[model samples]
Target: MKRKINSFSRKITNNPNLPAAHAMLYATGMRESDFCKAQIGIVSNWYEGNPCNMHLDILGKKIKLSVINQKNLIGFQFTTIGVSDGITMGTPGMRFSLPSRELIADSIETVVEAHHYDGVIAIPGCDKNMPGVMISLLRLNRPSIIVYGGSISSGFYNEKKLDIVSSFEALGEKNTCKISEEEYKNIIKNSCPGPGSCGGMYTANTMASALEAMGMSLPYSSSSPSTSENKKKECKIVSTFIQKLLERKVKPKDIVTKTSIENGVKLAMCLGGSTNLILHFLAIAKSANVHFTLKDFQKISNQVPLIGNLKPSGIFLMEDIHKIGGTPVIIKYLLNQGILSGDCLTVTGETLHENMKKIPNINFNQKIIYPLNNPIKKNGHIRILYGNLSPEGSVAKITGKEGIFFRGEANVFDSEEDANKAILNHKIQTGEVIVIRYVGPIGGPGMPEMLKPTSYIMGSGLGKNVALITDGRFSGGSHGFVVGHITPEAQSGGLIAFVRNGDFIKIDAENNLLTLEVEEEEIQKRKKEWIPPLLKVKKGYLYKYIKTVSPASEGCVTDQF
Candidate 1:
C-alpha cells in the first residue's frame, strides 16, 4: 500500500524522535519579501562593513587589514549560510509578497502537525504578518512567542535621514520637490536594515512593543535589530524559552491574562501606538476568550501617558530605544508609577515586576522613555469618541494636538485616493475636520493604513489646526489629533457613510464624543438611501478578506475564530 501524505502525516514524519514534537510546533509569519530584502553578514564582517569603516581605518591600516579585515573575511562564511537560512526558512508559502491570514494559519497548522511540535514561535513583521500570526497562534492555542523582524536602516533623501513613515509621505509630494528615483531606491534599501523589528513605530513595531510590554515576548527582544549579531542570540533565546515554557506546561493563555492585556493596552497608549493596535489587540484578546473591548482601551488611554518619542510621533528610532533600555525600562517606570500590572508573568518565566529589577536604573531624562511626572503627553495614550458620525465609537491619540476636539464643519473625502488628490491640490483648510471614508475593513477591504496622506497633511503644515477622522488606521508614529478605526465603517452603512461635506461634526475628547450635529430624521433619511462603496477586491485573498473580515472596531480580523 502506498503511504498517505496529509497534514497529519507530514507532522508525524518530520520529527519522529520526540513524540511531544507532535505537540511542539513553531510558526512565523514574515513579510518574506522583507526578510529576503534584509542584509546579512558574519558578526565581524558586519562590524567591519559599517559605513564609517572606522575599525578598519583605525588601529593602523596594515594591522587593521591583517587582524580586523582578515578576521572579518573569515566570518563572511556565515553570510551565505545566514542568507540561505533566511530564504529557506521563509520559503514554505505561496503568496510571497504578502500572505493572507488563512494562508498563514493553514501553513502554521501544517508545520505544527508535521514537526509534532508542542509550541510555536511566530516571527512576524509588517502590517498583515503580525495579525495573521496572532490569529494562527490563537487557533493553535499552544505555547507561542512572537519575534518581530527588526526595523530597516534609516535612509537618506535630500540629505535627510528618511524612515519608512517619511518615505510614504514623500511619495505624495509634488514631483519637482520629491527625492530622485535613485534616492528613493536608496531609501527603500536603507528603510529595512535587519530582522527582528519593524521599520518604525507603525502597527508592526508598535504591536511588537505592546506584546513585549504585556510580557508575551522575551526581554529586550522587541528592540533588537534584525541584522545585529545579537539577533541570532535572541532567536536562540526565544527557542530556549519556548522549550522551557513547554517543560513547565505554561501556555499562551496563562501569559495573556486580563492583567497582561491591560498592560499591553497601557503600553500601546504610552507608545502612542498604531490605531490598528486597537483592533489587533482586541482580536488577540478575543481569541484567548478574554473580554477585551474598545471601552477598555479608552479607559486605559485615559490614564497612560504617551512616551516613547519615535517616528511620525517624534524623533529617535527603535535602535535608540534599545540603547535607552527598551521596553523593560518603560514597564519599570509604569510599575513604579503604578501604571502597569507588575505582577503579570511574562514568557521569560519571571513576573513583569521581577524583570524590572534586572534593569539597575532608568533615565527618563534621556527621553527614550518618559516618566509620569514629565510625560510626553498629559492625558492617556488614546481617546475613544462616539457621536452620530460614529455610533460604534472611534479611536484617536491625544498626544500631539489639543484643539481638534471642538466642533467643526466636516470636509469629506469619499476615498483615500480622493483625499490624497485633495491634499496634493492644497484644498484642505484649517479648522476643517477631514473625513476619509470608505477605507475601513470592508471598505478598504484590508483597512490599509492611511498614514501616507495623514503624514502628508501633518508635514505640509496644513494639519497644525486641522483634525483628521477616518475609517482607516494611522501609523503609531503618526501624531496630531487623528481619529481612526471608525465602525461600522462607511461601507457597512455606519453613520460615517452618511457624513456629507459641510456637515457640522463635533469631536469632544474630554467627554469621549464624536457626534454629528444633524437632526435624527435627516440622519435616518441619509441611511435609508446610503449606497455602500463597491468592494475593492472581488477575487482571491482580498475577496475572502473583504467578505470575512470584521469592522475596524472589531479588530478587522477574519472569521478564523
Candidate 2:
C-alpha cells in the first residue's frame, strides 16, 4: 500500500485544459496527491427505504476503501434510484418498477461519460438495478466491474423457513380461511427479518447469479449474504480484482459475449429464476450489441439440468447456496459435466475454466446443489410455449410436480386485481385456466410482475389444480403452472385478447403448446371485433415508454426496433 506517487496515480490526466473543472474538484478539498491518482466511478444504488438496496452505501464504503486507501486510486460515488419491487408489488405503484431499469442505466451512462473516469464499479441490488448497472457498463465499454448487493438470509416461523414469499402467500391463506388472521400476522412479523434482497431465488438473486455465471461479476461474490462479513470482504476483494481487470484492459464487451449470455440462461434455468431474467438479459444483450435471441434462452435450457435446490420453487434460500461453496461450485459442477462452455472470458481476466479451479469442490453430501444424473428435474425448469394463443411465444416454469399438460376452462380477467380477488373468494374453479391480460410493456406500461396472484393461488391450495397465463411476467418466487410474457401482448392486439371465460384452453408444456382450442374462423371473427385500449398517461415517463417500448418478446426494451 506504499504511495509510489506517480505509479497508478499518474494514470490520471490533470491536464491544464479546464480551470473550472479543476477548481470545482479542488474546492471540495481534493489534494494534489489525490489528483495524481487514477479516477474510478462507483455507480452505487443506495437508499434508506427498503432492504434490497439499503446496505449498498456500506458496500460502497468498502469499495472506496480499497480503491483510495489500498490501491491509491481516487474513487467517487454516485447515487441512483433503486425502486423496491417488493414494496410496490400488486399496486398501481408497480407500474414504475420495470421502467426504473431504464433510468438506472441512463444515469450511470450520463455520469461515467461526463466524468471520463478510468475505471468504473457498479454496486446494485433488487431486480432492475443489477441488470441496469450491467447494461450501463456494457454501453460504456470501459474497464468496469459489477458487484451484487447479495441475498438476504431466510427467516423461520415455527421451525419452517420463511421469506417474503411466505408473507405474500400468507395473506391468501388467511383470506381462504386456511390460516388464521393471527397466524398471518405472525408470518408478516417473521418472514423478512432484516435487510437484504427478497430471501428467495427471485429476480434480484436470479439476476445476481446470472451475472456471475455470465462472467460479469467476480466469481462467488454474487452469493454472499447481505451485510455479512463475507459480503464486506467481497466488496473489498473487488477493488483489487477490478484493478487487475483495469490493468489487463478488459472491458465488459470482452467478458460478456454470445457464449456468456447463454451461460446466464443456463444458470437461470437450473435455478428456476424469475422470468424477468430473460427480459433483463435480453435488454443487457441489446445494450452490449450482442445478437442474442429469445429462442437462444430456450436452447440452453434444453441442455442444462435443473440443479440448484433453492426456492420459491425449492426448499433452500440463496444463503444456503453461499454456505455450500457459492456460485462457483454450481458453475464448476456444470462445466465439469460439459453443460456450460468454459471458453467465455470472465472479469477475473481468465477463462471460466481457470476461474472454476479457484473454488473448492462441491460437497457431495450437500443438499443445496444436486448431482447431474439425479436433478430436481430431468430437464431445465423453464419452457417456452407457442400456439394459437401465443403465436410468437410465451414462457412457463414447469416444475416436474405440475404435470406436463393441463386442459381446463379459461377464466379470463382483464387485470391481476380481478384474478387475485377470484382466488380469495373461491370463485376461480379448480379446473380453470386463469387468464390475466393487458399488462405487458405498453399495457401495464411497465409489465409489473404477477408474483402476488400466483403466490395467492398456491397458498389457497389451488396451485396444483389451477393454471395461470398472462401477457405480464412473473416473479422468480412465483411457482405452479404459470405462463407469462405472451408475445404481441394483449395491448398490441394479440390473440390472448380473444380468449373468452368459457373457452377450453389447454397447456402442453412437454410439447410447448398453449392452444386456445377454438376454431380459426372464430379467432378471425373475434379479431375483427377486437379494439386495442387507448391508454392516456398524458405526460410522463410512461407516455414516452408507451410510444416506443417493444413487446415482451423483444425484452420490453425502449429501443427503436
Query: Model 1: how far is 165 from its true place, Å?
Result: 1.7
Task: For candidate 1, give the lDDT of residue 349.
Answer: 78
lDDT of 2 by residue, 1-561 (tens): 333333332333456776777777888667866776667888789998988888899899889887877445678888988888888889888888888898898899888877777778899988899988998898888778888888887888878889999999998888878888888999888987877898778999899988898998888777888878888887877877767776677889998988898888788788878888888988999998898877887787778788777888888998988888788888888888888889999988898999988777788797777888888887877888899889888988887888889999999999889988888888988899999999988888789887899988988888899899999998878999989999878988999989998999999988999999999998899999998888837579988888888777778788646
Best by TM-score: 2
Report backbone clashes per prediction: 33, 2
After superposition, candidate 1 runs with Cα above 4 Å error: 1-102, 113-115, 156-160, 171-198, 402-404
What C-alpha lDDT does candidate 2 achieve relative to the native structure?
0.84
Instruction: Assess candidate 2 and give its TM-score to the true structure.
Output: 0.96
| Residue 420 in model 2: lDDT | 83
For model 1, what is the C-alpha lDDT against the true structure?
0.62
TM-score of each: 0.78, 0.96
Error of 2 at 122 (Å): 0.8
